[model samples]
Target: MPPAQSALVVGAGAVGVSCALQLARRGVAVTLIDRGPVGGGTSHGNAGAILRAASPIADPGIVWKVPSMLMDPTGPLAIRWRYLPRLAPWLLRFIVESRPERHRANADAIWLLGDQAPDAWRRQVRGAPAETLLSPVGWLKVYSSEASYRAAEGGRALYRARGAALEEFDAHELRQLEPNLAPIFARGVLHADGLFALNPRRLVELCAEAAVAQGAVIRQAEVVDVEADDARAAVTLADGDRLEADRLVLAAGAWSRGLAEKLGAKVPLETERGYHLMFETPERSLNRPVVWEDKSFVLCPMEHGLRLTSQVELAGLEAPPDFRRVETLIPMARRMLPSLAGAPTDRWLGFRPSLPDARPVVGPSPRAGAALLAFGHQHYGLSLAARTGEVVADMALGVDPGFDPTPLSAARWA
Candidate 1:
């Protein structure tokens, strides 16, 4: 394979923009195409946590709780009855991947990318406007009960073994750290190296700007189809225009499955619809992001307001936003922080492109010689964006990526 002279990247979210930036930096003529303005999709609505010490999604404990969580409308997880049939196949695979051995393997792979996330971001945003978007204040996870806190010991141990700097705080110490939190929280674990984005959407936009400054072209058009031969790839736009390039990178987030399939890889990808609520007039502001263990949500002080974000709804992409999921977060937020005031000023719903095994597809497409697959990042898309872009660029430029790419290969499904 020869180094690609030109590349076409689909989707303009974090992953796509990062890929464009890296490709442009390598002197490759790159065109980034998206339906709307940058960061308007899932990349805009996250909790703004640059979580590098994130745990794997294939936990056996969560598998046992799935049934009850699905049945409870107010629980952390929900599934639309109408989408159940379509979601069954992915759900079954999700369970199979929860086996102890598979779970450990997936966890190790995830940690490898996650542990390097901070450095990657630092290198990517060194002198760019995006540098101001990040806050390295660390993240705190609080538990309301002793048993729940004890159950998290295994995860704590795993993270510690992976070289994460962690500190456990008792109820008194936690209260001293964040005086605004309610007294109900009995224990807390703080990831000392955690980073948060004051505004996640703006971060992506700035990255896009930097890419443009580096000579990447941004095309505000939707990609309808893509075709590739042995030597080059062509992307057909919704307006019937076509673009030919030496390589194609699919980083389209939740909408990537169809595109990947066209490249000859059928990924078991599902849309994990997530909801969030933003409070405009919070009674108090927190110094860092906090995750409630039992509730499975995150409360972070953003540039606009205090954002309460979490919930995994197993509904297909086309379904309407169930505002109840957004509404449910208010009471939970109040319970955690009694000082929270005023009604929610904003509500959002975004789809996280998830895979059954919890690992993203980040290498070459088995079927398409000139195409590379880079989506299915699930919840870690924002955190893993820079590293993924670097790896993808390395692959496109015929350079060594310094590690085995087998773990994230799209051929695993084949």
Candidate 2:
């Protein structure tokens, strides 16, 4: 009888960490590798909107919206001019797939994937030595305009359909709920499913620690290449090191697509370059995370400081991080809450691993069963980490995933 083969997981972001932990938990020999600092990527800088009720930001209307969205540099979402010419076609496909029907379909698929996200995280964190995950109260979405407020109102039906609890808050009610909000902010919506982490760095760092404690090996090296054959997979490192594994799970976030291309799998993976700024503590925050409607970012209260993160720049991974965008977040954040103080203590910009259709790619590679590709989670990467690990692990074990992963696959690109 032969021994079971080892599994190699590339990338050490939240998704990669979660993948490694679940795989190791199942008793697979797991080796987690990364080129740079682990968890230094987008996982650390996200808005911390751990939404169990999150949906893709792309709507069929987005196709039409992109033209205008593309024009504004400081718009909530935009593509840099340098990256625009190459991204035109992808922009088209994104809009085409964002239709109402497509939105609902994608929503169903995404909801399926996110259904048990929080519960899975809770279970993983239960035995781990990680600091508290601020599942804090709930999430608030503020709206300055009536039209936008009404648009948010429509989600009530969608949430009810999906069996997720959602509530709409008028100006007075919203004010009562969050007394600190500026007077100009008239309406708001609260979703009970929202969760946040005060220290995302701590979250992923502790996850890595827990994973190592559970016997998973962490290799600090760049994976220059992953060669797949019928019998096994071999990963070559930039440092001229090589390791073998029976199965390869590519959860490398933004870098996953480029690596997937090495295997001749061309995925429509886009990078949503995101920016976040953490300010000196004004206080514990208005209680929970708030998705400031007009500004198009979520202001979260973390242990580090009041964090403001938003702006999705869809370009390639090679594109530079726009710290200026992160810098811009402070003004909007300060305006929303007068108490937020003068300036941020620290700012960060990281590229979010995004897919053209704003959904993640999971399951077997289009080419081989041995090549498992998981990335393009976009803004929901952290939120979807645990469930995606379960989904990917289920596929690897030949067990049935509780939901359909067809909506999230490389075949979509093929």
How well is each residue in 44-69 modelled by candidate 1, as lDDT tens digits? 99987776744667786778778787
Backbone Cα, N, C clashes tallied per candidate: 0, 3
Residue pairs clashing in model 2 are: 60-98, 60-99, 198-302
The count of backbone overlaps in candidate 1 is 0
- Once superposed on the true structure, which residue ranges of model 2 sit more than 4 Å away at CA? 1-5, 67-74
Worst 10-residue lDDT window, candidate 1: 49-58
| Top candidate when judged by TM-score against the true structure | 1
Model 2 worst lDDT run, 10 consecutive residues? 1-10
List where candidate 1 sits over 4 angstroms from the true fold.
Answer: 281-283
TM-scores for the candidates: 0.97, 0.93
Q: Candidate 2 lDDT (Cα, whole model)? A: 0.77
**Pairs in clash, predicted candidate 1:** none
